[model samples]
Target: MAKNSALIEPRLPRGFVDSEPADLAAVEEMVAKIRHVYERYGFDPLQTPFLEYTETLGKFLPDTDRPNAGVFSMQDDDEQWLSLRYDLTAPLARYFAQNYQDLPKPFRSYRQGWVFRNEKPGPGRFRQFMQFDADTVGAAGPEADAEICMMMADTMDALGLAGKYVVRVNNRKVLDGVLQAIGVADEGQKLTVLRAIDKLDKFGPEGVRLLLGEGRKDESGDFTAGAGLDPAQIAAVIDYVGGKVPSGNEGIAELDAMAALFASAGYGEDRIRIDPSVVRGLEYYTGPVFEIELTFTVQNEKGQDVLFGSVGGGGRYDGLVSRFRNEETPATGFSIGVSRLASALKLTGNLSSRPATGPVVVTVMEKDRIADYQKMVAELRAAGIRAELFLGSSKNMGKQMKYADKRNAPAVIIQGSDEREAGIVQIKDLAEGAEAAASITDNAAWKAERPGQYSVPRGDMVDFVRQIPAVAAWMEVNARP
Candidate 1:
């Protein structure tokens, strides 16, 4: 049969990629650790939908000029614009407002889900990515922000990144104060200046100076329009980012309060520090902002040594929920970029990159006795073993073995007519067999050792399979809460 000429190509969009089993497993592990920390801090889990009204996301959409600017969106049949959430915080604001009457005064919640962005993808950037966030709504004190910073530090410690990461805290108010002090009143120019300051780490002082002034061009010759700040304004912004923290303003007072709380809570500068440069990129941040930055240096794709920078960040957004409600609803939270953090962990050798093991596959040896093989699988499953009966067209033992190996299955169960008559079943430990094959050079010895193949009573098959070292270890690890 001739294949259809117009078979659509199988591919993902540039900014997205499929998560394989191992990748998923790594993310799951990281998320679990983060969840435990959040729960320990008394944050309950809350989940919002993947889509929200375009306006509900606040400034991301509903623009007739560029409906999908920075966010994926579409108009519904009823002519209402809906958009995939760009971040978890916006949805949380909507949710909190919608359920304000029933919710507690200070609603503390944590959520983890995928967020979508309609932006250009680059190294470590994706159109769809997972973020694990914890937020406290209705909390107006700087202590709330301090707790978030400390929680972030604890989360890093929980992830085995104890001394390798630091929670850098700052205040948007402080940045605003500096801008005010510099006599920059235009909101557009203020945002441009803040964005320039945010790039202090990515580009050094000179690069940021260019961004604060005329503009800067990248290695690809792409020009980015700057804040158009005068020399004096640029110098002022640079001086502030260079650790000359401003005082006397509410921002400075809040930072001082947060710093006191941090010291009282025993989080030293190594774990959590008051950094003057951590002005988060988000515009909604009304006050304190913080970021978790990995301190360890790693070689980039170009083999250049660079610090694995901010993996996660968040800040107080006192105005987000107010858009939904008539009253002021202050909120503070932090988000961990699951994919980026996983990548960092893998590079730092903290995240496991091992191939995921598959379930135990029971081979269908005799077509007529397929029921018998299935029964064995059921027994294994009933005993809490991950087992599945192989159902494929080829009945050849070699093909069956190959399938089992490809699955990375710890072992495979076989019950042929002869073995059935003898009331015995064979279990092959694939991992052990591969290891033995590599070490045992002689075919004779390989056959004699039968390294990982075992014949046991039919009734004891489940127990024998469970005893395989690889299977045993996997079960033990998975059995934990």
Candidate 2:
């Protein structure tokens, strides 16, 4: 044997994580909540392969400032280039084009999955994350755009973020028309201007003024090159973003036309507003573009209100499928940054509910009682309760209970030869044990107050555990679709 041995790898790379029960439950809750809202909006769920041919998914996302890729890439078995999808929307475009004739016209679907980008990582930014996306295929017009906006609002509400979030809407057509009016005909230059305008909220009008004209120097002393627009062109872009949210009846006239359709479907004014600032970064949008902006503000590193930026955004891309199909079919959609939203919620204290680690812990009463402990967990499982036997070997019974406490087990069941002979099993409510642990310094007082912890008939084990659901569960069930 060598004098020294090296340790095996045991940690994950940056931007990757494993969620324990406390963290995972919060994510699942939000996912279910958003999916419920999507289904209510007539969007069905969809999933696709993680890998795609690089040729099939062309370069369209602008302003990410990475190589011929922010996407992770590799070679296929035949040496064909392939890449992981950077956005859920891009994969949908590929899916639609591949199965155009088989699927219904105006095919509507919602997809939630992980995406990858090889972009630089920063605070609150990650290379791998999950997105919840929904798209309406084969629909043009503002009605589809309005539907997406409404779904965005409702989805926020469902996720307990209605009061905390807002959906800002703008028509890419409107912005494009504005650009055309400004005398920008070069297709490449047109896109550069559009992307610069999208960041108006971040850079402000003056900052955007620099992004449009010459390059602008950020406060961090970094330089960003402009899209090269003249003063006249920059002003037009500025006016739209800074424009008012026209009020009263005439103010929201264009918006009302779309809202009325949702009204008929019973979704009302609590969601969506016809704001002008929602120009997104993508050049593919043919009509409206919208973003889910968190209305609640958190201080940035620079200690300023940034409106929580966009946790998710999507818009009408009528030309995406056109690249594949001979005919141009219009499609509109929205995507939620599951990772970003999860991060914000965790920061803001919404995802703070701590659930009991699991159901019962079958304490290892003695070395000989392993079989008995295993049988106790089996009974709990049969009764629809989560449970596990104490896998750790310990001689001290007190240490076993301490282990149960660390596991956050709601209850601990113990069996010894004496209890087995009497057909009774000892059950301690760890949920109650926690409350008992926090106070009552005297061990005698602790034991006395836990009057609920006592031996029960083997047949009554399920009943005893059922009584503790309210004590251990941190979430409620809502079945309404």
> Best by TM-score, which number?
1
lDDT of 1 by residue, 223-276 (tens): 999999999988888888998876688899998899999999888898988888
* Residue lDDT tens for model 2, 1-481: 5668787789887766676777777788778888888898788989987888876667675643443477788997899989888788778988988898799989999999988877778777787888889999988666887888888887777666757876777666666666667788887777777767777778777877888898789878998788888887777778767773324433245456766776776665455666676777777877777888887777887787667768999888888888888888899998889978887777677665575356567888678767767877887777666788888868577898888777777778877778889998888876566665787788888767774477898778767776785423521342123
> Which ten contiguous residues of candidate 2 have the minimum total lDDT?
471-480
- Candidate whose lDDT is highest: 1
Q: After TM-score superposition, what is the CA distance of residue 133 in candidate 2 from its true location, in Å?
A: 0.5
Model 1 clashes, total count:
0
- Candidate 1: which stretches are off by over 4 Å? 1-5, 60-68
